[model samples]
Target: MRLVTFNILHGRSLRDGQVDTGRLAEAIRRLDPDILALQEVDRAQERSHHADLTDVAAAAMGAVDQRFVPALAGTPGAAWVPAADPDDPGTAGYGVSLLSRHPATAWRVLRLPRIPFRVPRTGPHRWPQRLAPEEPRVAVAGRFATPEGPLTAVSTHLSFVPGWGQLQLLALRRALAAVDGPVVLLGDLNLRGRQPERLTGYRPLGRRPTMPAGRPDHQIDHILLRGELGPVRLVDNPEMELSDHRPLVVELGARRG
Candidate 1:
């Protein structure tokens, strides 16, 4: 099965600071993933033209099932004001999402601990930092029927603060342990290398750098696997240019009889 993890940066392209649904859809089609884990997804946001990015992505990829979990109720990088109307089409939210070609029988959203207060120097310093209060973060998991049996896929966007991400990772590991069958963890973890394996005991499937899409140097995005599975291979598509981070695709072989 082909699994993909991407931080879409709210579907805004680096080339043009605009969220083009058509462009986003085309990019996802190129990857053609069986299961997709996405972060920084916008839902009913004006910036994305009040479009439900997760829905757009699901339709774009023709997913059989999909789920989105909002970490924040309002738009990111803006004031921490409540949405005037929660059901309003223009009410904005930021979160993570999962889409699968196979139907999901079960699903859950795990809320992770967030730092009580923001640090002045947190996150990548290159970009402008917003001082507004931030929303809580979360991870979403789904169970799907596969030829090899039930496989649990979890999608998350962890904290970017130093040391804080590790704490969130620990919470994720605990939440996933209760899931039955094999587990596939996908996300923009913000932490790199063997640390995830050390924290969660799930082996990393790929070691390619995915951030700063044009010239990546850190392997923050990942696909981690637990339980028995065949050899995995990374599907590199350097031409993908939708988000600031490059999408990660990996092919997992079915279990041998």
Candidate 2:
């Protein structure tokens, strides 16, 4: 099976500062992933041409099943609110998504709580600067019926705040305790290096730096597995035009059905 995790930055190419769906689709096609997890996705938003970016990605990858869980009702870097529900049918929203070529048998959602206060922080050489309030984040899971048996795949984008990302990861781990079968977690954790592995005990299938796509120096995107699966046949971080991070792709054996 070939699985990929990518943070598309809302399909905006940093090169020209444009949201070109054509380029996004082409990149998805080239990866040709059997299962794809995407973060920082836009839907019915003016920034991304009012197109359902998750749907676009699903079609691009030829995924037979998909789930987009809206984390915020508004836009990021502007104005937005925590979505009332996971399946927020709002005209405009942003969140994470999971797509699979295999049939899905079940689905689950987990909302990661964030810091409640908004305070300004100062750097070593700069005065205190108040940043935008932290936004709500979510994780979407899908249990698929593959030849290997039922496997649970989760897609999520975690908090960037210090220590908070680890808290959320722990919460997610507690929530998955009730689920059965092997598990595959994929997304941008914002927790670099081996932090996630140290916290969750899940084996990272790949270890290539993926941030600042132009010149990646550290890894924030990852593909982690909690249970047994086939050996890692190939692992790659495919360079693409959209997003600030590269797409981390992993392939295990053939017949990725």
Candidate 3:
């Protein structure tokens, strides 16, 4: 199966400020991944013309099964608060998403606790605002029905704060421990592959730089595996203006070593 991870930046094109829905659609259409993990997807946000990115992406990729995990809730281009239950899994806004060609067996959203806000040493950056007391961040997970068996897939956008991401990683590791069977974790960890074992038990398929506009010094987006699934391959989306970060795609088969 082909899999991909992308930070669409709400479908905005950095080139000429144009929204290349067709380009986005064509890319997804060509890739036609079996499973896709997407970040920064917008749903009804005024900026992207109130477009439901989840729907558009699925349609573009021709995915049969699709669902999204909201990182926060008020609207796109805004900070959000997770459900009080942190583990509620029903909230939606700016979180991660999983789109698959297979059916879904089960799904849930596990909210990762954030680091206490510090009075910015410098100042808040303009885009992708920081979390306030009200809005919390989270990771979305789904157990899907694959021909091989039940497969657990998780998608998340981790915290960008200094040491805070470590805490979020701990929470994610705990949440994933509950699943039984082959598992795949995909998303923008905001961390590099320097210490994969420390963040997640699985190994990263590739270590190519995946951040910053033009100059990427770290491999932020990753695809990891647990147990045996089959052969896996990492695919890099050719340099595009869709977002600051490039998309990473992975493919899986029915057999495993």
Highest lDDT model number: 2
- Model 2 has a clash total of 0
* TM-score ranking, high to low: 2, 1, 3
Q: Per-residue alpha-carbon lDDT of model 1 for 146-240, expressed as tens digits?
A: 77778999999888888889999999998788777789999999898788888999988877888779988878898999886667755563547
lDDT order, best first, reads 2, 1, 3
Per-residue CA lDDT of model 2 for 1-257, tens digit only, reads 99999999999998999999999999999999989999999999999999999899899988999999888888776788888763557658899999999999998889997778774555657686665677888999999988778889999999887888999999988888778978999999999999999988899999999987988899999999998888889999878988889989999773343
Q: Which ten residues in a row have the lowest lDDT in candidate 2?
A: 117-126
Which pairs of residues have clashing backbones in candidate 1? none
lDDT of 1: 0.83
Tens digits of lDDT, candidate 3, 61-161 = 77788877676675643555553544243334565678988898787878788655532332346554444443356777888888878989888877766
Question: Which stretches in model 2 have alpha-carbon errors above 4 Å?
Answer: 119-129, 254-257
TM-score of 3: 0.85
Where model 1 places Cα greater than 4 Å from the true spot, the runs are: 81-91, 121-132
lDDT of 3 at 178: 70
User: How many clashes in each structure?
Assistant: 0, 0, 7
Query: What lDDT is obtained when candidate 2 is compared to the true structure?
Result: 0.89
